[model samples]
Target: MATLARLQARSASVARQYYYRNSVVDVFRKKENDAAVKIQSWFRGCRVRAYIRYLHRAATVIQKRWRGYLGRQHYQLIVKLAYYTMKMNLYNAMAVRIQRRWRGYKIRKYCFNYYYLKAYLKAVSETNEAVREALEEFADMKEREERKADLEKEEKKRDYQARKTHYLLSTKQIPGVYNSPFRKEPDPRELRLQKAKPLTHPRPKVTPKRSASLRNWLECTRARSFPRSAVLPPIDRKPCQGPFRDIAEVLAQRYKPLEPTLRVAEPIDGPKEARAELQRQEWTRNVQDKLFLPFSSYHKSKKHIPAMHLSSKYGPDSYGSQHFREKNPERWICDKDFQTVLPSFDLFSEYGKLYSKAGQIV
Candidate 1:
């Protein structure tokens, strides 16, 4: 009996343990299923909300487009209405203008003419008989005055003719020199009087030496440092072998001419050198022409005639002349510096253009 009881108790404990474990597993499974169900419901809800939002956005876009279309239609309608109204107003104003002009023309042409004619007729018909008699008397008086003027003119003409005929029939006497009443007759001896010879006086002849004596004396008396012969003695120095002619020569030799690397083609002393060369050539040409050319050739070559004296104030190429500086400041003659000096430029040259570049003239 003891053994059976122990076995039955052990079986009952095992059954209870199994029942507890099964209940615990069931509780855990139900909780997991509930959580899964909740998550699925939340996901579905989110999808539905997203779809609703999408529908709202699509509807908003459609509504905006519809509103824009309607607004555009309204705007077009308003524009058409305004255009038609403006056209109608313009036509009406034109019609009114035409009507006004037509009415004014009709009134002026018909009514003014009729009124003027009526006034004129009334004045003519209301005229008095006394005025007509007075006008007739005035006309008769004018006729009588005209007739009197005509008779006076005829009398004057007859008197002129009678005077002319009487003068023509009368005899005229001409006065002779001997019988003239204006002057007494000259004596016969005075008429034969001989013309006396002009009085003679001798004029002393003057010598050139006498006239220039004072000038020569003054020149002799003036002081001098040395004899005139020693003052202008010619030098035998060769070209480019003398002392420096100007500070420019020194600068030219010191600062080399600009190379072709730069756009500026000339150096600082280039203009000075060019001007000096031009002056030297001009002087040489003038000297040659004066020595070799005939006197008649001077007129043609007179452009480079040597000046008697050099200007003391300004250099040959300087432009500080008071006469032209103010009048033409931009002209090369009026420039303060000799920057515009060109070696080969000539105002009289015919075989050149007004502008030149790179040996090509345009």
Candidate 2:
């Protein structure tokens, strides 16, 4: 019982301690929250006051700009109105001046025309008097000619009547014979049978021979010649001789073969192993080591093979190695005994001739 009580007392003490701690924490937190709220409120108030001041300044600026704009607009309006009014007055004055000048010109023109008409009418009247006298003479001549023509016509009619009477008396027609007005005698059979020449001959199929006149004209033309003032370029017609001995000698001296820097042994002889080793070294240095330079060994970029490059199963490096024949027995066999030989292309063949000499395949 005593142990249980002690345990209970311990629990009670722990509970009291937790309560005190929570109360203290709550009190501190409340104080902190209150202080924070006060500080935030103070900052908010400062911001609000600043914003209000800014708004006042902005409003003042806007009002000032608006007022200035209005004043400028009014001034421009007044200036334009004055300028337009003055311009209108100037135009009115110019219009009046132009009108006066035009009216004066019209009056002067009218007076000139009136005086010119009076002079023209006077001249026309004088001309008309002469014309009237000439017309009377012409009328008298016409009347006399008409009378002469009437007299001739009467005499002709009388003579014609006399002739008709004589012809009627002289002509004796057989009774009951009807003479047709448009009758003509039949042509002789010989004349009708005669063949007439064709008016137009058929054009020759062959081209007509050049006329004598055209030939003569061609012969008359002189040969064409260049103008005397024309200048012609000089041309060297003589065949070129061989180079001069002096030039040949100079060329020989200048372009002679360079002397050997190091003497190369004739009939070169070396051990097969050493030669092969040197060849291998050269192949590795030239083909393998430097072939793909400026690129990492693991670069994914492919090597660009030329269109004409031959593809082989064996790698290029192996071709240089001494063991190439062993590595690629088929290549060696083909190179030596089983070489492939392509037949020569016959250009005369149909397909071959499809490609013209100009390399165009049409």
Best by lDDT: 1
Off by over 4 Å in 1: 1-21, 112-362
Which structure among the candidates has the greatest TM-score? 1
lDDT scores of the candidates, listed in order: 0.61, 0.59
**Candidate 1: what lDDT?**
0.61
Could you tell me which 10 consecutive residues in candidate 1 have the lowest summed lDDT?
189-198
C-alpha root-mean-square deviation, each candidate: 36.6, 32.6
lDDT, candidate 1, 259-319, per-residue tens: 3422245575665588799989878867354343345764766544445564253456445
1-362 in candidate 2: lDDT tens per residue?
99999988799889999999998899799789999999999999999999999999999999999999999999999999999999999999999999999999988876568767899999999999999999999999999999999999986765555443332221135311122334464233212222222234469699765332323322326542212233332343332344322323333443446443112332223334577888898777674454432355655466745344454533555545644233445656454333233443344333322434553443
RMSD of 2: 32.6
The residue ranges of model 2 lying beyond 4 angstroms of the native Cα positions read 1-23, 26-31, 34-46, 53-69, 72-87, 94-113, 117-362
lDDT of 2 at 296: 58
Backbone clashes in model 2, listed as residue pairs: none
TM-score of each: 0.26, 0.24
